[model samples]
Target: MPTLASTNAVEIDGLGKRFGATVALENVSLAIPPGELFGFIGPDGAGKTTLFRILVTLILPDQGRATVLGRDVTTDVWDLRRRVGYMPGRFSLYPDLSVEENLRFFASVFGASVEEHYDLIAPIYEQLAPFKDRPAGALSGGMKQKLALCCALVHRPEILFLDEPTTGVDAVSRREFWELLDRLKASGLTIVVSTPYMDEANRCGRVALIQRGRILAIDTPTRIAESFGRPLFAVRAGKRYPLLLAVREYANAGTVFPFGDALHYTDRRDGLMPDAIASGLRDYLRGRGFADVEVKLTAPTIEDSFMARMGEPERAA
Candidate 1:
């Protein structure tokens, strides 16, 4: 394992990969500290999965190298596998096997019995105990995810790689999963989780933003959000298209994106106050034949931060 002060728990330097003409990851480099819950945040095609695969030794990198717990991912494949627990984006548990059987199977594969590592998986397993006899294929989405997580942890790994562990799970399940992760991290587990959920980025000790097979920014969530240096406004109306047009046509509009409830707007206006901007937006929407128009100054959120950082040139903040 990497020494405490000398090496990171996970390190990737000058990493690059390609699939024919498509570049999957490019010059990606990062150093994750011991016991840190690091997140790779991006969209579906943003190369999050590719990076995870390389780090866990599932795929080989073409240009650079990486080390996990001081073991090279490429050269020390077998050793790395024993040290890391990987829960891929999809559930890959045996469909015919029951939950308990699945857990026992994974434990035995590592030369350890279920009783030997029960403490490591007990928290997640408790939620799955009721369905222990149910076929893995018949379990609910959340239960299946929990089972997969438990199976990965059965051998007591030094690092856990969760690739969108909450992707298809219910809202309650997602909350519970994160809570369980917190408990495990409190016990000194190093976790690397990749997700398309920007909201989950803040829960991580640090986050790296990837897009189009390249890294955009990596920092604490607060630092990433604080980097946005513009006044923001949320503009809304009965119809979004015309409201968007009006906001875009507004002279002071700097950036505009469709946020969940409204269009988040930013501007380069120096002296234009929030009230003045709000007035201009309402008047323009009214002129465009939209009613019940509302506009308000709002703070930047993680989603807003992602849009501001990665959206197209015209919409960039």
Candidate 2:
């Protein structure tokens, strides 16, 4: 089969999409290399779905251009459809159908059989094998996710687009789903995935931090976290809500936000030592009559970097 004509499996130039007065996507441009696992990191309404739909030919862009496998998305959508696999954010399979039946139906759509491409989906399918006779709607959230993935891969497409594949699933299922993607990547399938989870960003080979339908930063997770360019600290105490507000009111607080059980923060005082900052934070919380407090230097994470980028002004890429 003929594949992409260039090293890039997907390319977008100034892509824009709007629904009524709302801008679903704005001037989005990106290049996805062949056989690479690229992630579109963002929350809901960040235009991740809109961009994916355009690339998949499910919708048309109001402006700009995009190509899939080197074929124009607008004019060559049929060809693109045949070469790419897309697992939408929703589980759109026939819920009433049994697992094997659904898989066979999707395979037939692409004029292929599940057995013909079983190896491509074996890792994920194996997890759902026992439930092959169960109705899709009756399966667990994790199993439904796996079944959707198998249906998407049944035709052996060269590239895969997964939109928020982990949302609503349990933590263990989410991790397992990503592990499956990792295996797929190792097998030379180019994959594009979108997720709101910051930790999932680290699992991708490269990620594009997006917000409000714009690209914030595009690089490996390590580079994006390192670009924070601020001394970060984590503070925790009893009464987490009040602690968050109190930390934000600190005079030297550059950026403050609750992170898991601790508040991830940055100091505004440019050259202040970590010890001094921690001391000041501890004293401030203590002075407010709260005895329990722990403030210390903490490494910046992908969430911290994403929040930092969210606060910064958008610059031209």
Candidate 3:
């Protein structure tokens, strides 16, 4: 049996799982160092939740091995459970319970007290203190997430696993939640978070892009975007739909996809200067009667890299 490395807070090798005909994870492998803010970036059904559940000891993997904090997920589950804090994707606390009740309940589960770990959750608890008397279900989305986070942290676990902690919250709330995560990371906590939002990748120290039960790439956000390694341009015109179609129909078009309010275009020909490619594309659109066409060279984003990788053939395990 392979032993978990001492340096890794979490480790998985050839981890896999399935639900009858549905494959949740396939040949997944990765290592997370302690105190790192690691992120699993993917859309829904990409196996992020499954991977998290296994690490948190909620479920067993069908094959391969995984360990959290040097404890085997399958063998040392009882000890691991007490050492890790997990905030599931869904709100699992009693909706009828008041905010304070929920926090106290979770603390007691691990044989701890809210007063014992009060310092750990003080920052987040202060916000929820005002709503301590309100039913958990009655709080706004942001407050509910904060309360859930408090419950998860009340036990003072060595590592934290949050499954899409910011999903379904308002944009302002999302930003605030990330700020809280940043503070936790600075406090030397190893946090493993999964989210479908590509923009959030920037906040992670390192991220793994998972799709269809496999990892496409894993690196720092900037490096992952830089790996898109092809001349790319963002083109916009009066009509986005027509512009997308026209760009896709271009003979030299390598990849064309609608991004935000513009179309991100890549060319088939390599080694061509970006300015030349942009000029040629502008002329082509002008000739096609899109008089107000604007095509400019733009840097690739993490989403662009994910989209590009999604089109390639999957690697062999």
Query: Considering every candidate listed, which one attains the maximal lDDT?
Result: 3
Candidate 2 residue runs with Cα over 4 Å from true position: 1-4, 313-317
Rank order (by TM-score, best first): 3, 2, 1
Quantify all predictions' global Cα lDDT against the true fold.
Answer: 0.86, 0.90, 0.93
Which ranges of candidate 1 are over 4 A from the true structure?
Answer: 1-6, 239-242, 268-275, 289-292, 312-317
Q: Is candidate 1 or candidate 2 better by lDDT?
A: 2
**Residue 292 of model 1: what lDDT?**
89
lDDT of 3 by residue, 1-317 (tens): 65455689998899999999999999999999999999999999999999999999889999999889998999888988999999999988899999999998999999999999899999999999988999999999999999999999998999999999999998999999999999999999999999999999999999999999999999999999999999889899888888888888888898899898889999999899989899889999898889788988889999999999977854433
Instruction: For candidate 2, write residues 206-240 as lDDT tens digits.
Output: 99999988999999999999988888888888989
User: TM-score for all predictions?
Assistant: 0.91, 0.94, 0.96
lDDT of 1 at 69: 91
Q: Would you list the rank order by lDDT, best first?
A: 3, 2, 1
What tens-digit string does per-residue lDDT give for candidate 1 at 1-317? 54233368999899999999998999999899899999999989888888889989999999998889988888889988999999999889999999899999999999989899888889889989988999999998888888999998999999999999988677888888889899889989999998888888988999998888878889999888777666688888877887787778877678888888789988757777778878877787788788888888887876777777676533552
What CA RMSD would candidate 3 show? 1.9
Distance (Å) between predicted and true CA of 212, model 1? 1.1
